[model samples]
Target: MTPRSRPTAGGSTALPGTDFGHLTESTRPLVELDDAARIRSIRSERWIGYPQARSVLGHLETLLSWPDRQRMPNLLLLGSTNNGKSMIIEKFRRTHPPTSLSDREQIPVLCVQMPPEPSPSRFYLAVLAALGTPIRPHSRVPDLERQALMLLRATKVRMLIVDELHNVLAGRDNARREFLNMLRFLGNDLRIPLVGVGTRDAYLAIRTDPQLENRFAPMTLPTWTNTPQARSLMASFAASYPLRQPSHLASPEMTDYLLTRCEGTIGELSTLLTSAAVLAVDTGAEAITPGVLERTEYLGPTERRRQFERHLP
Candidate 1:
């Protein structure tokens, strides 16, 4: 067969290419799958792109089009733990997957997790690895930095996303200052937007340096509440659960239980629904109800954090 006419792998399209157009604009992809495929889809990790997530994506898209950068604008996306910050950024990244250029990939958006402790060398290492260009195994800091910056340019990276930026705060004061300075230099050097994503502590970190603080416009994903938007988001999520019966998650009783159990965070809410959906499938119930949720063993973020804190000292 001609290369252009290569057959799809074993014709096994259990997922993808389904008529998911009926789903809400954000979740329409889920509508394409049959029940079994939908159940499998729910089990895997995915991005929901809720309202807050969409807003962040819009901000990043705007930044991508900014002209030659002097005083380039940056973004700081901060929110509570499990409030969907990473998901938002990841969704944006997926929407712009890498493209093949002349014998190399032109990664428009390069994202890396901030090291648990801040160090310029470690930051460079993360970026280099993400770009598939590892520095020498035992290279010095300056060498790693040089290679990373060069590759970031060569690959035409339009945006640099450092998730878990708050981790810098765990390092010493001087280290934090150095990391922030490195970020400033990187932004100025690359002339691309630098997006920082983490909990509220990330805002505190960025605020330490007046220059850095001034550059990043802040966007926060506040905890969800019992509002129409929140209910709509929940409903959108439940619609993808693959259950035969509607979960009616937006009903006041169900919504309150879900919010209370999920601690009003999108990540937790998603996990809870996914877990309940999987269990429903296993039990042959084919639907999520208050009884199913009650039987699920998932714990809310607050309770889980409390449990960990109690064991300390």
Candidate 2:
């Protein structure tokens, strides 16, 4: 009899063959818990598929299925930090995760982070690492390029997703140009869709090369505002929390309060809700309320930074 190997997610043992599916380790174990335990369970990280994200995911599915063409289709997912860009990409990846085919594991989508500084060496290294390909640290550009290209093709990667593409904005002009050229060359060489996820600067980065910009269509996820859809988003999100009573998180005052606390980003909003829920659990409230929100450790980005900055003199 052969033993089965379990997967690791966030360092916890996961069921064999489980691909870290949408339900995170944080929220998966509370299938039948009371409100208090549910609050703690609901505090886990989760995916909230708002309208824009669902539409973007649908477009990504189309791109992945696109037949190979001279000018391969690509996407530039532009949005503010913590506005759910990465989450959308992550959901897409999970949907088309690696699968074994004819003894070869085919990674339909490959997601990698753009390096802090844009350099060909770093770019190749990141790709190689994603593929779990070991390499000599001092390998030359040509060797690394050949190695990366071979692995990408062998893995049958249909889509390459690069997150935090705005990091390229930090590189110098020559490096930036080279990086953009590399992107164009890769699409031409591999005939695979390239999905770039980053802040709005990522669109600007792609635009630097008119040809690349033309090849990749732009998709934007704007910051949240007080709207019916936004309120609905809040309500849908709040329903998932384990609370004794309905939170009414989308009520006028609550909506404004959450928006301000989240700094208008869905990611921050999610974190704030998690924190508030957890605090409520600790305090026996079991529901998110203005009092619970006030007691939460959650802090908006600007305010959090301001706190640290104030003590630095």
Candidate 3:
């Protein structure tokens, strides 16, 4: 009697006629999750249809379209979370490529996400890294800052998008002073538009640095208020994902439930919806249902409690 090879749980044996490599690849996990961070995209299609989102994009476009003779004004994007702030910046870059014709006129959008804890040295290094510069292992704060500015000048970048400006506070009093000096130096000395983006705290951060604050005019991105605009945003979300289709989520009740749960934050909304879609795909459901949404464990304890309380009698 010939011994039989054992088949894997999915039924096909690896040592036999089946192409195991192809089978394993086909059966690979659907939604890729890493260290509690959901890797969802923030693009127009994913953005809940908010007119303000479009407005923000238009504002950035105007900033980028400054004529040859003038200096681009510094812009401050101040808003609470999920107000489509980052989306606007990204969309602007996509719709309008930042490149100048001549070397002196060359334009580049340098986006740097500020760290939770920031110092002068850290800030300089972070900015340089964001600009794709090679950071020397033993470089000092001043060295990095000098190199960053030199590269910025050499590249002639028109706009510097500093996301999470609140991180400058991660330093000591002296560090903060030095960091603000860098901003002042960049604004007055370099003649490039420096756009700062962060939560409401970002506004306060800029306000503290009088020189930096004076250089930037603040623009606020408003959160959805459950008004007609909210409905329009929901409609936009529907259009983007097309819940009615078999290959996606389709529960109207779940959609309303999501809005209630997320409180109309674009980032939270996108995150929740994307998660639900992924859950549906995982469970072999062609359309998302209330049951699937209920089964999700991604919502934080506080958020879930709020959601539960709101729905309760």
Worst 10 residues of 2 by lDDT: 14-23
Residue 254 displacement (Å), model 2:
1.4
> Measured by TM-score, how close is model 3 to the native structure?
0.70
> Comparing 1 and 3 by lDDT, which wins?
1
- The alpha-carbon lDDT assigned to residue 259 of candidate 1 equals 87
Q: Which candidate has the highest lDDT of all?
A: 2
| Cα lDDT listed for each candidate | 0.81, 0.82, 0.63
TM-score of each: 0.86, 0.87, 0.70
lDDT of 1 at 12: 25
Give the least accurate 10-residue stretch of model 3, judged by summed lDDT: 30-39
lDDT digits (tens) for residues 37-97 of candidate 3: 2123212244343677767677776776665433448888988866678778877666645
- Using TM-score as the yardstick, the better of models 2 and 3 is 2
lDDT of 1 by residue, 1-313 (tens): 1011222444322333344332445445443344466578778886555676787788899998888757789999999998888878888898899999777789999999999999998898999989987468888888988899888888999999999999989999999999999999999989999999999899999999999999999999999888888888877877766554466788776788888888888888889999998887677665677788888889887788899999999
Query: After superposing candidate 3, which stretches have Cα over 4 Å from the reference?
Result: 1-49, 67-72, 96-107, 242-256, 279-292, 295-301, 304-313
The top-ranked prediction according to TM-score is 2
Tell me how many clashing residue pairs each candidate has: 4, 0, 2
Q: What lDDT does model 1 reach?
A: 0.81
